[model samples]
Target: MICGVKQPILLVLVHSAPENFEKRKAIRETWGQDQEGVKLLFMLGIANESEVEKTLEEENVQYKDFVQGNFIDTYHNLTYKHVMVLKYAVYHCPEAKFLLKVDDDVFVNMPNLKIFMKLFMAQNSERKKILCSRMCGNPVLREGRWGVEISEYPESMYPNHCSGFAILYPHDTIFALYSEAQKTKYFWIDDVHVSGTLAKKLCVTHIGLEELILSDDEVVEIVDSSFINNTKPFLFGRMNLDVHQIRILWDFVSKYTPKKVILDYLNY
Candidate 1:
C-alpha cells in the first residue's frame, strides 16, 4: 500500500506495552486502519513474563502488525524501542516518506494528520525535519525518578529535541539516527536520548507542531466542545485517551469527517 498511488505519506510506529492486548485490538479497529497513504506498525519489546509473551503472541496472531525488538519491554528501556524504530525504518520501510512515532495512549485524527502533512510539506522543503512539540534546554536530573547517573549524561542541560509522545520524522533522518544510536552511549530517557542527543549529533531540524497537538486538558475541552457543538475539533492529535474515549471520539469524528477525508484525498 505504501509506494502505490499516494507515494506513502506516513508510517505510524506506535509504542505499546507487552500486555496491552485489548488496547492494541481496539486501536486496530479504530484509528489504526492502514488506508490511504498511512500504514500502522506497532513497536514492541520482549516481555519479561512468559504469560505476557503468550498474550502478545495471541494478539499478534490477530493483527500481525508488529516490529518487535529483543530488549526488555520496560519504562527504562524505551530508548531500546526508540532505536528499534530507527533500525526498522532505515532498513525495512526506507521508502516511506515520514515516520510518526506516537505513544499508544495518544489519539490521532487521520484526516487532520493528512492535512497537517500537506501543510507541513507545503511550507517546508522535503528534508530531514521533525514536526512536533519541540523541547529545549531541559535540565538533566540527578536524584529524581527520571534521574540520570553522572555516567549516563554528564551534561547539565538537554539539547533541543522533539517531544517523543508524538513525533513526525522525515525519512532522511532514520538511517542517520539509527547509526547515531548505535555509537552514542545509551540514555534511558528515550526522548532526550534518541530525539535530542542523537538528533542533535546529526543536525536534524524540527518544526513546531504544538498548535496541532492537544494537551490533556485540551483533550477534555475538545471532547466537551464536540459534544456541545455537534462537531469535532480540527486538530492533528490528542494525548492520553483510553480505548473507550478513543472509540467515542472516533464515533463522533468519523461521522463528521468521512466526507472531508474523501474530499482531501481527491485534492491530494
Candidate 2:
C-alpha cells in the first residue's frame, strides 16, 4: 500500500509520466497540497532508463506519495496504470468516499470540485456514479497517433466514455469496475476500457457530457478575474500548460476576488 494518507474522503490519483518532475512539483506546491479530508498521490509506471529510475526513487523518498506500477510508462499502457490505481485503492483505501482520476497536465479546482461533490451527493444521495465529460460518435482511428487494430476493438464507433483526462468515481463504482476489469479483455485505450466498456459491463452509473465541466474555452479564460469569480469548474483539461502557466493560473484561482467584494465594502 502507498503510504502518507489514511481514510481520506477524497483520493486524487494523478496519472503522471516518470520524467515530469517539474510538472509534479508545480502541482504539489499549488492545488495538490495536502488538505483536510483529501489525499493526493501521483501514479506512475516503471521508468526504462536508470537515471529516470534514480530520480523517481529520490522523489518518492522526499514526497512518499508516488505509486509506481510494474508496467512500462507509455501512452498505450495507460490502461495498466489505471488498473494499478484501482487495485491500490481497493486494497488500501476502501473507506474513501470518492476517487478522482486526473492526468498530470490537468488543473483541478479543488474548491470547486468540493462544492460540486457536495451538491451532487445532496441531489443523488444513494446513487453510485462516475462523473466526467462524455465523448461519443468518434470513429476509431485506423492509422497514426491514436490508431487501434481491428482485433483490439471491432466497433467502428466508440461507446459513450468519459474523457480520460479527468474522471470522478464513487468508491463502490471503482471497486466494481476494478473487479470487472480483472475478467475483461484488455484494451489499450484507458478511458474506453475502464470507464466505458468495464463500466457498462458492471452496470455503474455514468454521468457524462455537459454534466462534467471540462472546457478548453473556459480554461483559456481562467486567468480572467471575472471568470474566476463567476465560474466553478470541477477540472480543466487540454491544458498543455508549462510550469509558469500552472503557477499563474493557480495564483489567479486561489486569490480571486469577486467584483462585488469592493462594492459591498463601499456600501457598508
Candidate 3:
C-alpha cells in the first residue's frame, strides 16, 4: 500500500499505562526502524483525563491516543480492553498489511518478523488470508499461569486458539471478527472471544507455531537478559509476567548477546 514496498505495513497495537510507559518506550527504542514501507502505531490507553496532556508530554505519546473502555470497568486489567483494541485497529489503521495486536509488555523480533512476512507471502501470495498460531483444539488453562474458569466456555479447554499475548491477523479478517462479536454475546476472555470464536466465523486458521515467532520460554529469556545484564531483549511479554519476575529475568540474561543467548536457548 505504501509507495514502494510490496509488503504491507505492519500495524502494532500497543496498550500502555502510566507505570509501564517508560518500559514500552524503551522497547520501541530497541526495535525502531524507519524503513520506507513499515510503520508502528502505539494505541495507548490514558486512564486519567487530567493527566492526559501531561502523560502525552512525559511519555512523548502522540495525539492519536484513545481512552480505554470495556464491558467491565478495570476488566481483566488488560484483557478487558480487547474490544477497544479491535475497534481501533480495524476502524483506524485499515491500510496495514497485517495487524499485530500485542500487549505493552511484549517485545517483537522485527528481523524474524520480516522472515514471517516472506513465508506468508510465499504460501497464499494473496496477502488476504487470516493466519494465527494454530492450536490443536480448544485449549483451556487449568490452574496454570493464565488459568481461568468461565461458565460460557466451562469445558476448561479451547480448540486451536492463539495465545492472546501475540496474534497476527490480515486486514480483511478484522471485519469478519468484529461482525461476529456484535452478533454474539458470549465469553469475555479476549483470546477465546476473538482468536477462537470470532476467528472461526472469519474463517481464520492457525499458522504453525515456530520457535522464532511465538513461544513462552523465549519471552522469559529476553526479559531476563534485559535487566540482569542491562541488555534489551526481543519480544518480552510483560503482561503475563510479574514486575519482580521481570526484574529477575532481566538480571539473568542481560550479560549475553541476544544471538548467543537465543542460540544457546535453542541448543538446550
- Per-residue CA lDDT of candidate 3, range 71-135, in tens? 32333545446666667666766667677777656555565455555555555644434454445
What RMSD does model 2 have? 5.8
Best by lDDT: 2
Ranking of all candidate structures by their TM-score, best first: 2, 1, 3
lDDT (0 to 1) per candidate: 0.76, 0.77, 0.55
TM-score of each: 0.87, 0.88, 0.65
RMSD to true structure for each model, in Å? 4.3, 5.8, 6.5
Per-residue lDDT of 11 in model 3: 67
lDDT of 3 at 225: 48
Which 10 successive residues of model 2 have the least lDDT summed? 259-268
> lDDT (0-100) at residue 158 of candidate 1?
90
Model 1, 1-268: lDDT tens digits are: 4333266788889999988777787788888876878778899999999998997887788777888888899989999999888777777677887888998887777766777677666665757766677887788889978888888888899998877888888877788889988888888899998888888888787767665555666557546565434243344446667888777666666766533332232111
Query: What is the Cα-based TM-score of model 2?
Result: 0.88
Model 3 regions lying over 4 Å from their true place: 1-8, 32-34, 44-80, 125-150, 214-268
Local lDDT at 154 for model 1: 84
